[model samples]
Target: MENSKEQVIQLNLNLIVARGPPVPTIPVPVVAAPPTITVPAFRSEKFSVPEQFDGTRSKLLEFTTQLRMKLEVNHDRFRNDAAKVIYSVSHLEESALDQVVPLVNANLAAPFSSITAFVANLEALFGDPDPRGTALHQLVTLKQGKVDFATYYSQFLRIVANLDYNEKAKIDALTEGLSEDLKDAMTYRTDRPDTVEAYATMLMTIDN
Candidate 1:
């Protein structure tokens, strides 16, 4: 029985020796890096608030322009119509502030359904009554006498654009503003331009 026991122990020792020591595991790292997160463009920069508005017709246009630019750039900052309206109202003074008092107090019951409605009201209250008429009067007197063709063209275009004149009217006004030398050159061209853009190009070529 002792011999049988010794034989069993030796057999177990042999089985243990057959198997080698266990290997430890080490994890391999990933080759590619994680994606980078990007922040919003507007959040990176600072913007100034628009200047206060005092209900002056001449300054109204400038005020609205500044306010529009400010709101458009950081749209996330002004998410809704009420937010935009409140921001604009904050910059008002005297008469302008007085005008929006009822709307501000009304809150949810304000007449302004949209920011556009609010701006239109402001324009009606303090904007040029006869803007087109004013531009037309200026256009009739504008002459390209001493200035270069390019300069005169830029000035003429700015005034005429405000009037929304037809193609024929644009050509007529363009021709009328030409210097004496250009007017003389126009008479010689057999293949004249029909469109306003083509006409402007023809005049530029002649001027050059």
Candidate 2:
């Protein structure tokens, strides 16, 4: 039963702009930490690519030496013996390529326990254990046959250089490969030369 006017009193509701309390502040220090250098985890540069091996007996040493150097530098990639052997087999060609391709195809690592064993296998297959003896045998059995003097001489020098023959022995070995005509010409017209160089000169002169 209160008066209707009192019940209908107007609310002031004036436009009010309110600022919120400032957020909790963190103290800023004057000096900042110096920039840190980021050290690289590994060397980005890699070694030179190895020479492809074609299973030549004379070149086995070179091929193996270069491959070892390459593998050592890329040790991160070749963490295990299998990895090293597989990487080595990647640099093969011709008979060398054929010899191990099957193992790789079968997803096999080196048949032996270590990469060194794998290399030893390669050595047995492709390397000359008796280079000096082989060279001597080649010189002893060589014959000029139908080939020209230049060709025969080059072959002779290449094989002979591997041996330690003295001049007289060189002359004696050189006598083995002379063509029949060269032998006849030297025997009849030429005086035997004491030095192997003189003998070689005389034979070349007759051949030309």
The 0-to-1 C-alpha lDDT of every candidate, in the order given, reads 0.83, 0.80
Q: How many collisions per candidate? A: 0, 0
Minimum summed lDDT over a 10-residue window in model 2 is located at 9-18
lDDT of 1 by residue, 24-128 (tens): 688898799878988755562446778999898878877887888888776677668777777778899989888988878878444477667877889999987
Candidate 1 versus the native: TM-score?
0.59
Q: List the residue pairs that clash in candidate 1.
A: none
Predicted structure with the largest TM-score when compared to the true one = 1
Q: Give lDDT tens digits, candidate 2, residues 1-208.
A: 3565554442222212134456789999889889999996776368888889999987887788788888787787666888788777778899988987776777665545666876887898998889889997888789999887778888888788889888888888888788999988878865889887788888888888
Query: Best candidate per lDDT, number?
Result: 1
Candidate 2: what lDDT? 0.80
